[model samples]
Target: MKQIVARGALAGLLAGVVAALVSVLIVERPMRAALVIEDARPAAPGARGGDLFSRPTQVVGGMVAAVVVAVLIGIVFAVVYRWVAERVHRQSAFARSLHLAAVGFAAIVLLPMVKYPGNPPGVGDPDTVDQRTNMYLSLIAAGLVLAVLAHWAYRALAKRNWPGPMRGVVAAGGAIVLAGVALAVWPANPDPIPPDVPAALLWQWRLASLFELAALWAALGVGFGLLVDSSARRWAAGQRAAVAPT
Candidate 1:
């Protein structure tokens, strides 16, 4: 268990580093371009820059933060892998890791994002930050709850003698409907973008943000699976050697 966790963490660290680089290269460059446009606008009297540090400093700081966050997420992934090992019947470490990562991306990213999508900097009203933050967090929590319920529903329905594909279809369909209902009931966020902000820039920035997250998950899933599989093979070889007549 300890070894598994260590390997997972190492994989996560690597993934995070890769993600940070992606952000710096692909995401941040466009963001800075947008910021240049924003800075050209006339500021309200007494309006000041958000950060004390310069752009380069912030970029480096963001990379460091991304790595730290990735390590933490890796630990969580390790723990989840252990938990899922008991409940799921995946035959290989890679399969199990991929499954978990897919489910995670759905629950954590896709679901909530449908309701409250990502926005680029300067897109949101500062006054509504608290309200938006609360709503976003609530949606994420609700999405996770729905994911858990969906898994439980699948398990419960599996106990019945229904055909496998049929059961999956029914379970997944029900979950999707429930998620849709949840989204429908939730209040929509107001469009907070100023008229001066280019729609094209906003669209591209949002896409970049989503891509950054996708990259992180993809890297973590594949990297962790490789590490776990390699470790398992080594352990099996050691065990076989110990048991062999020598």
Candidate 2:
């Protein structure tokens, strides 16, 4: 287990590097454009370039943040991987990892993003920032609960010997319905987008952000899965050799 966790961290480190590169290459475009808009606005007396940090500093910080967050996430993945080892029921460790990552992405990233979409510079209403943040956080917790419910629903069906297809469909459908209802009931963002920040540009930024997150999750899943699969293979080979007559 210790070895597995170490490998998971290593995989996460690599995955972070991949995510960082994607952010630098793809996300930079829209982000820079947003910055341009931000610069044109009247700067508050104390603001530096109308922001706390320069672009270069922000870029570097973003990369480092990505790596650090990925490593932590990797550790969590290792722990969760152990917890779900038997429950996932997938033949391949890789498949199990991918499955868990998909659920995590949906439960954490995708859902919150839908509820409180990220904005680029000069986009958000500063007065409502606190409210927006609070709502976003609550939604994230709700999403996790929703994920647990969906998984539990699937488990209940499995215990009853329901077919795999039926179990998945039912669980997924229930989750979607619940999510849709919640979204409809939730308060919309109180901030009207600044007219200066074009919708097209905002969407491009959003898409880029989503793509980066998706890439991060995908890389983490694939990297950790491969590492686990490799470890299992080596363990099996060693056991076979140990048991064989010389």
Candidate 3:
């Protein structure tokens, strides 16, 4: 378990660095475009506007934030992998890691974005920040609940001797339905997009952000699975060596 966790952390660290690079390369262009709108706003009408740090500093901070968040997610992934090992016993380590990563992305990123897509900085109204935060949190928590139920649905179907492919489709479909239901039930963000924020730029930034996050999770999952699989093979070989007669 300890070794698995260490591997997870290492994978996450590497993945985070990759994500940060993606942010700079892919996400930053759209973000800079949005910042142009911000600069033109009446309140802050200059190049250096609306923050303590310049764009360079903000970019560095964003990279650091990505690394920290990835490490935390890696720790959580390791813990969850332990919990779900029995449920995914037949899958290879790589497959299991990827399946879990998809679940994490769906619950934490996709579901919430269905209703309240992300905005680059300087887009939202300041007055309703609290309301927006609460709404986003509520959706994230609800999405997690739906994921749990989907897992339960898979287990229940398995007991009834359902085919593996059928079980997976059913579980995934049920989760999607539940997410839609949550979107219907949950309140929308109180704050609307500002008039100045262009829809094209908004979506561009959002797509980049989504892709960056998905990349982070994908990298971690693959790296962690490879490390774990290699470790397991080594341990198995050692066990065989121990039992062999001299």
Which RMSD values do the candidates have, in order?
Answer: 5.6, 5.7, 6.2
CA deviation > 4 Å runs, candidate 3: 44-50, 231-246
* Candidate with the larger lDDT of 2 and 3: 2
Which tens-of-lDDT digit does each residue in 106-200 have in candidate 1? 77888888888887666777888898888888877887788778778877877886676786788778878988998998888976678877888
Instruction: Residues 1-246, candidate 3: write the lDDT tens digits.
Output: 897788788888988999999999999999899888877767734545357988899999999999988988898898888788867788878678888888888899888888898899887777888888899988999988988999999999999999999999999998888788889988877767888888889899999999998899888887777777866557667989999999
- List lDDT for all candidates, in order: 0.82, 0.87, 0.86
Q: List the residue pairs that clash in candidate 3.
A: none
- What overall lDDT, based on C-alpha atoms, would model 1 receive against the true structure? 0.82
Selected candidate, larger lDDT, 1 vs 3: 3
- Count clashing residue pairs per candidate: 0, 0, 0
The digit string of per-residue lDDT tens for model 2 on 1-246 reads 898789779878988998999999999999999988987888778765445778899999999999999998898888888888868765589888888889888888898899778888888777888999988888878888898899899999999999999999999999989988878777888988888899999999998999899998998888888788877557767989999998
Q: How accurate is candidate 3 locally (lDDT)?
A: 0.86
